[model samples]
Target: MAQKRSIFEEVGTNEVSKPAPQGGLIEKGRKGARKGIRAWLVVIFALVMTMIAVGGLTRLTDSGLSITEWKPVTGAVPPMNEAAWVAEFEKYQQIPEYVLQNEGMSLSEFKSIYWWEWGHRQLGRVIGLVWALGYAGFALARKVPTGWHKRLLFIGVLGGLQGAIGWWMVSSGLVGERLDVASYRLATHLGLAFVILGFIAWYVFLLGRSEAELLQARRNKDAKLFSMSTGMLHFAFLQILLGALVAGIDAGRGYTDWPLMGGQVLPPDPFYIEPLWRNFFENPALVQFIHRVAGYLLFAFGVVTWLKGRKSANKATAGAFNLMGALLFFQVVLGIVTVLHGAPLALGLAHQLGAVALFVAISRARFLSQFPKSQSVREGL
Candidate 1:
C-alpha cells in the first residue's frame, strides 16, 4: 500500500476533489425537494382554483354582499347563536342591497345568502391559515430549495392582499347609490385572484422542470418556443379578465342562446348604456358578446399554439401543447353548455372551473417550453 498521507497533504492536483460550480449545493438539495414542493404547490393551486370557483358561485347567486361586515378574526368563526345570526342579518338589512332589492326578506331567506358569503369568507380564512402554516413550516424545515423561499413568501403576501381586496369589493356594494359592487372593482378583485393562481401554477411547473434544460441551454429553438408559449399564457390571462368583466356585469344572464346573441353576431345595441366605454363593463348583452367572441379567439389561438409546438422534439413541450389543446376544447364546450342552459348555477360554476384549468394548462405549457431539456447537460451527467 502507498504511504499514509496527512489530511492536508496535496494528493496530486489531478487527484484533488473539484469544488462544485456556483449553484451546486443549492441545486443538489433542490433536486430532492423539487418533486415534493411541486406536488405541494399543485395541491395548493388546485385548492385555490376551487376557492375561485366557489367565489364565482357566490357572485352568480348574488350572495357575496350578504355579510354586512368584514371582521377578519371574529368573522372566521361565523354566527354561532340565534342572537348572533339576528345581529348579522340586521346589519345586512341596512345595506342598499336589502333596502332596495331584497326588502321584506325573512330571516330564513337571509340565511340562504348569508351562508354563501360566510362560506366564502371562511374559505378565505382557511386558505390564509394554510398558506402561512405551510410556508412557515417549509421555511423553518428548510424543505424549499434556495431561490424559492422568497417566491413562497411573495405568494403569502398576495394571499393577504386578496383578503383586503375581497373586503374592498364588498365595501363597494355596501355604500353609495348602487346596491351592487362596482364592476371595475369586482373585475380587479377577480383578476388579482387569477393572477395569483397563474403565478402558483407557473412556479410549480418551473419546479418540475428544474432538472431539465432541453430548451433553455439551446438559444434559438428555446427562444422561439418560449415566445410562443408565453404568448399563449398572455392570451389566456386576457380572456380570463374578459370573463371577469362578463361576471361583473351579470352578462351571463343575457344571450341565453348559443352561436348567436338575440339573432345578431353583435348585440343590436352594443353600447346603448351610459358612456360608450361603459358598455364594455356594464351592458350585459355586450359584455356577454365580447366574452363569447374572446372565447372563440382564445380557442383559435390555442389550437394554433398546439399545432406549432407539435413540431418540437421536446417531450414536455409536446405534452404541454396537447394538454392545452384538450383544455381549450373542453372550456369551449363548457362555455357553450353554460350559455345554452341559461347559465344554471352548476353549469356556470363548472365553466368557471374550466377556465381556471385552461389557464393553468397554458401557464404550465409556457413554463415548460421556456425551460426544455438539454442534451449537453444530460451527456455530462
Candidate 2:
C-alpha cells in the first residue's frame, strides 16, 4: 500500500484550497457613527424634555388659548408694533376663555400670556428645523445606519402629528362656553409626547452599543425582569395621562389635601356630573381621586419591579434598577408635596420633572435587562 499523507502535510498542489474568510460583522462595522448618532439623539431628547416643561408651564399659566390661531408658518413673527399687537389681542378677545374668564383683561396683561404661547410655538418650530437639518445631513452623507432610516423618520412623523393634535386641543377652548380644552384631547397630546420621548430613549439605548454586541447580549437577557419593567413603564404612562386630566381641569388645585380627598377616602360629589362618564374627565374631585389612587398603585408596582431587578446577576443592571427605585420613591414624595401645596408652579414643575426622571430610570433598567453589560465576579458583587 502507498504511504498515506498526514492532514497537516502539503501532499500536493492540487489539494483543495480553502475559500477566503467570509465577512464577519462587516455589517456591524458599517452601521455608521453610532456614537455620533447617539449624541444627536441625546440633543433631541433634551429638547423634547424642554418642550414638555414649557408645555406644562403654558398650561399652568393658562396661556395655551392666548394665540387664538394656528398660523404655523407666519405666526413665527410675533406682533412687532402696537397695531399688530392690538389686532392679535382682538382675536383673543373673541375666544370663550377671554369672554367668560378675563372679560376686561388689559392689553398689557394679554401680552404676558401672549408671549408664553408664542414662545411655545416658536420652540416647536425650532425643534422641527433642527430635526430636519440633522436628518437631511446624515442621510445625504450616507452616515445613517442601514436600518435606522425609518426609525429616525418616525420621530418627525410623530412631531407633525403632535402639532396637529395641539391645534385640535386648542380649538376646543376657542369656541362654545368652554374655558379650556377637552381633557381627553389634552391627554392625547401629552400621551403622544411621552410616546415620542419613549421611542427616542429606546433608540438611544440601542445605539449605545454595536449591533453584534447587542445581539450577543440579548442571548443572556433576564426575561422576567424585562417583563416587570415593561409593566412599570405602562403604569407610569397611565399615571402621566391621568395627570394631564388633572391639569386640564385644575384638579390638582381642587384637592389640596393628601392621603385623602375632601377629608375622606373619596370625594363626596365624585359623580355629581350629569353623565357618569363626564365625571371622570370634568369633575375635579373624581379625576383627582382617580389620580391619587393610581399613584399609590403605581408606586407599589414599582417597588415590586425594583425588588425583582435587584436579584439580577448583572451588577450594572442591579445598579440601574437601584436608581429607578430611588427616583420612583422621590417622585411619590414629590407628588404628595405637589398636592399638599396645591400644585403651585414650582412644585408642579418639580413633580413633572420627577416623573420624567423616573420614566427614564425605568427605561434604562428595562433596557439593561434585555442587553446586560459584562459583569466580572471581581467587579462589585
Candidate 3:
C-alpha cells in the first residue's frame, strides 16, 4: 500500500501549525479576570461605605451601647431563644445608658435597638468574609497585578485594625462611669473607616491608569493634584471626626435650628460648666457649632476645587469636580434637614450616606488631578 500521507501533508501544509487563536483566548481571559478583580474591588469599597453608614446609624440611634460586651465571634450569632434575649437584655441593663436613659424600656423596646446593633455587626462579618474570599482568590489565581498587591495588603491590614479599633471604642463605654464611648475614641474609629475608604479610592484610581501613562503623569501633574487632593481628604476626615464628636456628646439634640443655634448666632454660654479647652469636645453646643463650621468650610473647599477642575480639560477631573459640588450641596441640605427633624433616623442616615458620597467624590477628584492630562485622557489634540 502507498505510504499514508500525514495529516499536515494531506492538508497541503509543509509544517504543523500551532493554534494562534489559543494565545488570543488566553490573553482575553487574563484581561477579563483583571476587569473582574477591579469590579470586585469597587464592590468591596461600596460595602465598606455601607458599613460606615450603618455604623453611623448605630451611633445616632443610641444603639451602640445596646451590646455591652464585644464578643466578636459569639456576637456574630444573635439571640436564638427567649432566654438568650433576656440574657442579652440583662447585660445591657448593667450599662449606664440603659439604666439612666432607658429605665422603662421593655424587652421589645430593647430588641428594637438590639437589631440595629446586630445588623451593624452582621454587616461587618459579611465585609470580613467577602474581603477574605475575594483576596484569597485574587492571590491564588494570580489575578491582582504585582503593583497593587502591597497596597491592597496594606488596606486589608487596616481593615483588620479597624475592627480592633471598633471593639476598643466599645470597650471604653463598658468600663467608665459614662454610658457611652468616648468622643475621641469614636472619632478615631470612624476616622479609620474613612481612611480605608480613601485608600481604596486611591487604589482604584491607580488601577485605572496604564503603567506607561502613570509614569509620565507622575513627573508632570501628580504633585499639585496630589497635594490638593490630600488636603481635601484631610479636611473631609477632620469634618467626620467633628461630626462624631457631635454625635458622641448628643449635640444634635440641643441645636435643632440652622444658620443659628437656638435662634441665636451662637448658643449662650456653650462652655458654662467646664474649662475653655473642654468646650470643643465636651460642650454640646460647641461641638455642634464646630461641626457646622466644618460643613461650611468643606462646602467652600469643594466648590473651589470643582471650579479649578472645570478649568482643566481632563474629563476625570471635571467629573470629580462636579461630583464634589453636587455631593456637598446635598450633604449641606441633608445636614440642615437632619437638624430640623430632630435628627430623625431616616434623615440622619441620609446625612451620613451623603458624607460618604462626598468623601468618595473628593477622593476620585484628587486621584484624577494627580494624573497628567495625557494619561487621564487620550492624546492627540
Candidate 1 TM-score over all chains jointly = 0.87
Cα lDDT computed for each candidate against the true fold:
0.81, 0.91, 0.80
Ranking, lDDT, top scorer first:
2, 1, 3
Q: Estimate each model's TM-score.
A: 0.87, 0.93, 0.86
Better of 2 and 3 by lDDT: 2
Tens digits of lDDT, candidate 1, 180-234: 8887888888888898898888777677565434234445356776787788888
| The candidate that achieves the highest TM-score relative to the unseen native structure | 2
Candidate 3 or 2, higher TM-score = 2
**What's the count of clashing pairs in each model shown?**
7, 0, 0
| lDDT tens digits by residue: candidate 2, 1-381 | 987778897666667888887765687557887788888889999998999999999999999999988999999999999999999999999999999999999999999999999988898998888889889989998899878999999999999999999999999999999999999999999899899999999999999988888988999899999999999999999999999999999999988887878889978888888878899899999999999899999999999999889878789999999999999999999999899999999999888878888888889999999999976787746
- Angstrom error of the Cα, residue 155, model 2: value is 0.7
Model 1 deviation from native, Cα RMSD in Å:
5.1
Provide C-alpha RMSD values for all models, in order.
5.1, 3.8, 5.6
Ranking by TM-score: 2, 1, 3
